[model samples]
Target: MASVLWFRRDLRINDNPLLSEFRQDIVLPVFIFDTQILNKLSKDDKRVSFIFYSVMKLKNDLKAIGLDLAIFYGEPLEVFEKISSICHIDEILACGDNDFYAKSRDEKISQSYKLISFNDAFLLPASYGLKKDGTPYRVFTPFYKSVLPFVEILSQNQYKIKSAKLVDFDYKSIQLESFGFEKADISHIPYIDKPMELLNDFKPYFDMYKDLRDDISKKPYTSGLGIHLRFGTIGIRECIRELILYQKEGIDTSEFIRELIWREFWNMLLIHFPKSEFDNFYAVDIKWENDKDKFHSWCEGKTGVPIIDAAMRELNATGFMHNRLRMIVSSFLTKDLLIDWRWGERYFAMKLLDYEASSNIGSWQWASSTGADGVPYFRVFNPYLQTKKFDKDGVYIKRWVSEYKDIPSGKLYDENYLLMYGDSFYKKPIVVHKVASERFVRAYKDGMIK
Candidate 1:
């Protein structure tokens, strides 16, 4: 009896524990184009295109090794049923996904088949990172400290993949058009076949990450490993290994490693409190003044706040946004516009090519001050101050917001100067910063009293 290697988020074969375990067996690799998730996405969704590209790449890699990847487009359960009918599958091996939907899906799958799943995406498993009292951590610092030792030990446990015996099966891939998604233009998307090359390229910048990461106007000072990490193209263990090597070179890798810990921290929170994905983690009443018009403006990058607009436009165009800009734009939506963080989170889920549920939701909540260890509710990011600090030269703003290309750097921070450009050329600021800041604080305070 042969085992089926079910690939979900963990797409790559390198450092994949699930794939490594079934190397000696007649393993048939499989990926289900989950329609339940796909139905919600746009036809030109870059994320869907990226996933399709990754799946295709995985298929070719497996084909070269005399194995075949069975690609199916349907509900995962139905797809598994079809797979069972085609092959005499004894067991299904897959990496455990920590999100609520994934957990529910995996539970149903386990009921039907001999499912052997491992938490291959995160450095430390969800269960291993809890407090001494066995309660889940609400804050990041303690959580990071608690998991550090385990992370160091497990970071060394990298998976070695041996050749698998190819099973005789008619393997086929469902066309992108079959699922109502257009054929992906992989030109703009950074889909790396060998993640190691990307990691190596990022090494030189790792030391400067802490200093220049927040500088939005500059070229990417941080590692652009998010998309690769999201799909498990590169395993977390391998990333940690790279960090270890960097540390040995006397590089201050603490800042970069902290980011990886943050990713794991969010994953742990999702595993422990699944409701945090949709609802506020802490029980607090919120009166969301969700203005549809303002929300649309924010989405289209027409809010007239150069930094906010730039970030939004970048996300709309590339399906990716810088980390600092993500916080800025998110804060603008939730705090400045007084919109619900869920609104921003939903939009990110729709657009971000590197969208991971836990990270997206967690980060949105952090910016909106609704999550555990979130920024204080009173602390709203002033777009003018942020622009002056991060994009002092308006280079980032000029790149995304075309109308602001020739605007003076000093004038970019002036609301009145930006307004002079007019609604015809550049949009006027939707809300006065001073007024909105006061209104948001008052509203939050009133909600707390009620």
Candidate 2:
């Protein structure tokens, strides 16, 4: 009998629980570029290209053994329909994903096939985070505390690191280009470089991640392993294992470890409250001040506030922004522009290289003061003030918004638009931040009272 190893988000070979225990005679490993997902990605999505490249990396790593990865491009159920029709299969083992699309797809797959899934996406197992009450934890810190012991236990003997062996598989007929996606050129974007380096060997920065993490300009200093986590290029368990090893060596990697815990918090949130994928967690009687024209301006990074514009433009151009900038820009959208969190969420969904539904929705809802277990509604962040604090020199802003020449001239705080090679084309801030803050605050306070 053959056990099919269905690859969804977990794309790597290290520390995968589902693959580790599959002691079957014939094991078939298959990856599907499910159209349910691919159809939604843009034609030139670098994230898709990254995933394809990572999949190829996995296949090459497996090819070191005498096996080839079977890849398919179609609706997942359809892909399975064809696969099960031709290949003799007994049971399907996979590392289940916490995202909406992945869960729905897995449910459909399970209905049609014999499926047993495991949690390889987190340091703490997803099941361990629940209370005696049988509900998932909404607050992050308590959840973190609850799951700490499981993380400790799993850290020991996680991956026994056997030879890079693939459980022999026959590939199915498939072509990625047949679907509407392009090969990665990876030309101008420097962020896409050296992913394996960032994954396997980067350790120094994670030790300092606590102090250096929030700095917008020092972002590349933080090991840039987020895309790795998002795509599962480096297994979550591997990251935690390394973190524990660092701790044993008397290094304080708690901050980096906390970020991983946060990652688990997000996925757990998605699992317990799937409805949060599109809807707000708490009631906000106040209506969103959603202005399309303003949102468009914001999208173009012309919102007139330099930092917000810079952050938005950075995201639009490169599909990434510093985590601090992510919060600042999101706050500007939901609070200052009075746009719905959903609007900003969809925009990030389109643009971010590391976009995950749980984090995106959780962050946006937190900014909008409509999510449980996040920033209080009254705590609105001011982008101009935040820029002055985190990016005092405005170096990050200048990188994306070249028109802010005054900052380069060392007179930006004086407040007149410094000519971008001599023209004032940089957009103006859309609404007065203070005015918007008061509006959002009063409305939210009133909503809470009501």
Candidate 3:
């Protein structure tokens, strides 16, 4: 009997549960560039380049073990059907994705083959955590406290690759041009070829993460593991293992562990409440203004507010933005501009290199105050105050928004001051922050579900 090992988002060979799970005499390891997803992305999408790079690496890694990775381009079902005609398929082993498109694709594939999915992308599956009432935990603190033991246990867990004879099918070669995609310039992105280097480099400063993480000027204070984790280039378990090792070495890793668990929290919540992907988790009807012109300004980094413009510009240029900046800009878009969080979420999905659907959706909802464990609507972030606290010297601001380099750091924080003394190239603030925030809070109070 032959088993097909399908590599989807879990692109790594190390600590891969699929490699260890297959017990069939013959194993066909394959990767399909699903046209369904690629059709929606732009031709110059950086993520496609990154995935292509990782898949080639996986192919080489598998070949080192006397196995080859078969490459195909088509719809998944059609690709699998072609595979079945060649090999007597017993089961398809893969790491499952919980997103809407993935769940539907997996369900459809299960009708024809025994599709066995393993939770290798995340530390634990959605079913691992529950309150006393047997429902999922909505709040992060309670969920973290409840699942801490499982994370500890799972961190130490390791996997060994089992052997299987390679199915001698014609291993096809695929290139970026074959998929009609041009190579994206990912020169600015660090650790593309090796994600572990970033983690190892961050180890010495793990203790300072909690204190300096929010400061935008301290760029290296944050770990750039998001894209690696997003692609499963580095397994979640391996990350936690490293974290545990650091803790044993007398370094405080509690803050870093908490951030990792936040990623898990978003993943679990998405699985439990799938509708939260497109709808508000809480039953609140928000009357969003959703001005396209204003959204365009925000997208183009013409928002007049220094912090918001700087963050948006950074994301546009490099496909990355600091975590603190993400929260600030998201809140500004949803609350101050009164745009729908969905609009902001979709925009981020289009632009962010490290975009995870669960985290993006959950975070956008949280910023808009329309999600479980969401910030209260009344707590709107003042962009000026945020700039003062996080980018006090305007170093980060000046790095992204060149027009603001001549303006005083203190003037960048004040909207009125910028209008008075800033460069002519800078646009006027879209709306009065105090007025817009108060309006949103009142509107939220009025429209909330009783």
Candidate 4:
């Protein structure tokens, strides 16, 4: 039986159910850098580069064991047609994907091939638990608690594929450069990749993740493995094992582990409520300002707000931002700028190397107060107050917005931040917090209160 192991978001070879099971059969490891998706991406996209790099590593590892990767680069359906004509591909196995495009794509392929998907991307199985009435849980905490006992946290060393026996294929891969991937300057950006043996370097910091995860200035203390998780360079199961192992050692790492559960919970929501990708999940009547000029400034980090702009610059520059700041910037964009959450959400979806539609969309809606268990419209974040509370020393602010070193003489722009984000250096904020807050309060009250 010739089974094809179709690699999608789950890119690694270790503890990968599909990849591991394939070694025991006459399997052909295949990765289709589906042009349908890639054609939509920018040339210097790190996510595509990361995917190319990881799959190359997989191909090379397989080659070391006399096996090779059969990469396809067209529409998945057409590629399937070509593969199906040459040899009988009895089964196709892939890690489950919960994104809108992925689900529809999988369905298209599944109609043509006998396919099976495993939970390699998410810790919890995509299956939902129901009440006696058999309905999906609406709230995150209860759904999270209900699924806690069923998690299977597998260790990195659990899988031992002795060899990758060659399954010859008459196929070719488009070189990464030809696909428009170039060398990236990763000097300033913080990334944690296990394939490069980054785990030992960060082991000392994992225990402190609980205390420092939300600290705006010290994001390195939290495992910056979002990219790894996004690309499957680090498996969800492997991360869980590390979490559980540390807990047994009496390390209080619940906060970081809880974040992983959040990722899974969002994935669950994506599968059940795919419409959240574009439309509002709860408040359907809400409207967003679609000002291109305001959005451009926000994207370019000229929002006049120090912390929000700093976070935006960081995301624009490094493809990452601290979690604390992500929420602040998200909220500021939605309420303060009165911009559509989908607009900010789509930009994040494009720039974040760690971008997952499920998490990205879920978080944007959560911050906008249009989704489940989010901040009520009345509870808006004041960026100035938030900076004073979380980044008291101005460490993070200084690092990103280097223009603001000294407060301006006399209170010309902002007496508090005349130097760093002075009126001259940054654009004046599109909307004032007090007015915007009142506007949101009234709008939400009028729409949802009654």
Task: Using TM-score, give the best candidate's number.
Answer: 3
Write down the RMSD of all candidates, one decimal each: 1.9, 3.2, 1.2, 3.1
What is each predicted model's overall lDDT from 0 to 1?
A: 0.83, 0.73, 0.89, 0.74
lDDT: which candidate is best? 3
- Tens digits of per-residue lDDT for model 3 on 284-338? 8988888999999999998888999989998998899888999999999999999
* Over 4 Å off, model 3: 421-425
lDDT of 2 by residue, 1-450 (tens): 667778777777766665566656577788888777777878989888887877887777656655568898778778777767776667788887777777777898789888888877665656776987988888888888888777757766575423334444465445446677887654544334345455345576766677777787545656667777777777777777777877887877787778777877877787788888877787666677788899899898876677777788878887878888888888888887778889999999988888878888887887787886868677889775677677788777787777875545233322334222223455445576678889888767776735
Evaluate residue 247 in candidate 4 and report its C-alpha lDDT on the 0 to 100 scale: 72
After aligning candidate 3 to the native by TM-score, how far in Å is the CA of 73 from where it should be? 1.3
Clashes of 4: 2
Better of 3 and 4 by TM-score: 3
Better of 2 and 3 by lDDT: 3
Candidate 2 segments exceeding 4 Å error: 132-135, 157-175, 187-196, 199-201, 407-425
Off by over 4 Å in 4: 22-24, 152-165, 171-173, 186-193, 196-200, 408-421
Q: Ten residues in a row with the worst lDDT in model 4?
A: 407-416
- In candidate 2, which residue pairs clash? 289-338, 304-428, 304-429, 305-429
- TM-scores of the candidates are 0.95, 0.90, 0.98, 0.90
lDDT of 1 by residue, 1-450 (tens): 688888988877778876678733788788888888888877888778788888998888777767779888889889878777877778888988877788898899889988898878888877775888999999999998878777778998977876778667768667888878897565765536666677777777878889889987767887778888898887788888888887898877888889999998898888898899889887766798999999999999988888888899998888889888898889889888999999999999888878889899899989888888887889899999988998889898899888877678888898777666657566788888888988888887877734
Worst 10 residues of 1 by lDDT: 184-193
lDDT of 3: 0.89
Cα RMSD, model 2: 3.2
